[model samples]
Target: MTPEDRFPGPELPETGPRARLALDPLSYGYESGDHGGPQQPWAGPGYGGQGHGSQGHSGQGHGGQGHGGPGGAAEGAVHSGESSTVRGWFEAGGGATASGFDPDAPGRPPFEPTDPPTLDLGAPVSAAPPAGAPDPLPEPADTAPVGPLYAVGDVHGYLGELRAALYEQGLVDADGHWSAARSRLWFLGDFTDRGPDGIGVIDLVMQLAAEAAAAGGYCRALMGNHELLLLGAHRYADEPVQSSAGTASFLAAWRLNGGQQNDMDRLEPHHIRWLSRLPAVALEDGHLLLHSDTTAYLEYGASIDEVNDTVHELLASDDADGWWDCFRRFTRRFAFRGEAGPAAAGELLEAYGGHRVVHGHSPIPYLTGEAPGEDGRPPLRITGPHVYADELAVAMDGGVTMDGRLLVARLPLE
Candidate 1:
């Protein structure tokens, strides 16, 4: 039976291991009498020398002379008289023929074939098989856009404001529970560390995640600098970190960065673990959602997965300095407000494979320089979400922590 017929009517396993080997028969060449083993037949010129096809003579110890026969003596004599001599038997289809001689001392030079075997050194090397099909990336379920993903800007422990914002966006009911059926919700991550009820905010979001997923929608979060700062402060409070500015402690920085004493007091082990596990960015529905707007993420990794993994790994490490740098970078914002803003946003969009970036590190009011209660005047009205970087980025931090409105809106389909 043919090889194909041998496996007829049988199901082959889709995923299994297989072994393979390659054979190259005519890889080298030789002169007349020189012969290679069956496996390596060709022994063209320079087959056993320094350049090209040379596989230096082995076992025939004394340089060029093979030790067993009368031909050995002739080869030794030729080598003795000349500084450089090619001494080897040139075999033909008929029998062994001796070639190459000492041109200086010899009375008559030995018969030299006009066209000796020339090595084809330009033969191509075997290439490795194309990389085994890469493990496929996780593909979005269907072409149909999933849901109207709405991410809440920094709640900063302001539970009342968070509830009001959710209710206003039709995501919650009168009882203050998630009511947006099958609508994806995400907290753009500063769940704690500013106002009262930081833990309450997290509790609400976690409960909402379960509720949303159970109802065929999903609720997730990304790690903000506050999360990392809080984690670092709790885990390495006693550790001192040396920075370019000066020696600073994580606990101190956290407090100065609006970390509330009550929130830190209420922090538990599970909360710390959960915060540390939060990714720095989440790509959802063609949007790259992150907390900060800095290119420092490029230093974390080249790809989205790499950046997330590296950031999480660094947060897990006990190196206070590394964690501090991560926190510092994560807090930087307004990268899209300057001349290089477009290029910076483009870099992030390319790396994360997103059409636009949605972030919460900088509040829209701050970007617009219209913070409320400033200069003893009323706050300017913000009718809608702020789109910056020529509409390539959206800033959602509405400064709710400072009594400004918390933003909750559907991603613009356009």
Candidate 2:
């Protein structure tokens, strides 16, 4: 069954104070070496033991609840209170597997191995309702302004930073998960690549969508070029393709961009299928959400859904060069940075039907001249989530992968 179908709990109420759910801290295990007991493997690619990967999945169960109060605790497991334990699971196998237990399986016992496992107990346990308990519908906060929309820039596998930024924005709790009620969150894409835990980032976002929807809010993500590249590499790695710059291959680009060897090794059929099905653009609350800030979308279709459908159809084709070109064009950034950038921004606004365009493919630091190692220049600080471009575009990418902040903010009604 689909996640929505599997998680058909009561919808959170549309009017009330923000409902808070305390999450118990959870633990996980990792295999060391091929023997799967925390030892480095000395042989061929190690699958480890069946139960050596569980840390991140434990945390994922409570991701939609705001991160606050006492964290949950794991029952009958060794606890390694290291956030890296969660990171390792996402990065370990390139995020191919789901680390957490299935929430839908209420009676499924936790994985128990015969051998001692590398355990990670994240946070303390909380005595909250059981996973299958009927959740009270959360009421919407009338006091808050309407059209409470938010956009996140590229996550790029920096799960810790993304969580911290979400908390800072009051969207999540201290644990780096979502919690706000009756709010809308739009991710501008590029969730993986060039950092640790790209897979982890995607897993978190996917989990949040279920959580947020249950809580009377919504979390939606756009398809970024990196996602396309990752999917392409997994499906068409051995297939060569032509590019604007020259002949290019997704596998080569993925590796050059620090694609984790573990990720490629763990590329699963489901992950590729999900990435392939991602939509290209999303529009909500008078804002346009996309990965890149270019007018090239006109080449696809007129309506937002049409464009997404067209792109999906193209990606499904066997024409490797066409797919690569689409990936390359989407990867381009800084279309709204310079003096002439406003014109390009206007063209997009005219097509996409949003007063403002929110995107993450290009980070805000790169636009404001604060990115590290930019010709020996010092980094610049991002003061807020919204960056106005000729008063038509909002750059949401906070450059979290490069030590910049992650942008998270509610959309203000005009």
Candidate 3:
């Protein structure tokens, strides 16, 4: 059977895992990859509205946009619709698995992560406003437009940083409820591994998804390479794969990276299914949201919809090699940097739809290429989102594993 056969037909209920939101995916413009068959709409409570697709792909709808901001139209009431076609990040390598932003340097994690560290909040490492946020969103100069679009960098299991950052934006109240009624939130991916509370991070994101949808806004996530690792580790558990590096398996890679025992122990079947279904690319309000800044996405498909669909299909199947291939592609990084960076970013924007690429995965410090302190410490402290590659790409991994910040930023960065 084809990959399309892997999914339940339209006759299935939308309430099932990762159901598509009601409303035509086409109305929002762009294509959301649809397997060649009738589509089923998600029966999200209070979530009946038009959904948006990325520039050129077809697949699952990103998020359904409801009433704009305070006025729903004054200006800025927008959803990340940017992530309909989403992918992840990491380094499987040799061009087959890695997409180097630099093309010459190593593309995966520069080093195994430091043990999950706590942020020194007192330090002045906050990302700037309008682009990278630590400050609460100021009252809209005018009526808030559709819930203003916001994208988060990789959480990497840093639940405390995640919660604090979300709270700062007033997205959640002191009690962590969905307070950003109409604002759209997109987590760029990498919800697990290398940190202390991967499971907690997943739980909170899941909770926020339901709460946000109910409140008329939406909270969606793209899958990251770490998710791939977790799933592979779970399913294969040391099952060897064909690798240039002998005897490698997903579990080994995950452990070599920062897979936490607590997280693996806490993972649930629902989480696996949810991760399996995340799209690999998307375009929202002109932003091409992704997990890694690699051109490897092109190999998946020419358009965003095709990329997402292809990824979804692979994840839905039992093709260990196929899944491993997907992991390698998303893990490639630095493709959108250097003299050729603009072209790389342009390539994605040209194919996927979106003016700028917003992604997580490669930490900002890696993008800057700044070495450690003169005294020999880790790389430079990150100041949140790193806008480089001639501004075509925005790197949002704040080096949280290294005790740097976790960023949650507004898009179209003022």
**Which of candidates 1 and 2 reaches a greater lDDT?**
1
> In candidate 1, what are the lDDT values of residues 212-235, reduced to their tens digit?
555455668988877887787677
TM-score of each: 0.63, 0.63, 0.65
Candidate 2, residues 301-394, lDDT tens digits: the string is: 8889789988989887887777876775565455554555667677777887887777766555445544343145555566555454556777
lDDT of 3 by residue, 1-414 (tens): 111001100111111112111111111111121111122222111111111111100111112322211111112222222111112222232011211011121112232222222122232222212222222223322433367788898887778889999988778867666677778889999887656678899988887777766555678898887788788877765455654323345654554344555676677888888888887787889999999777778888988888888888877778876776677556656566555667778888998888899988866654554423224555466645777666777777876754467888777663
Q: Candidate 1 — which residues are off by over 4 angstroms?
A: 1-145, 372-374
Worst ten in a row by lDDT for model 3: 4-13
Clashes of 1: 14
For each predicted model, how many residue pairs clash, with residues at least 3 apart or on different chains? 14, 32, 38
lDDT of each: 0.53, 0.51, 0.56
Error of 1 at 273 (Å): 1.7
| Top TM-score model | 3
As for model 3, its CA RMSD to the true structure in angstroms is: 19.4
Candidate 3: segments with Cα more than 4 A from true spot = 1-145, 371-379
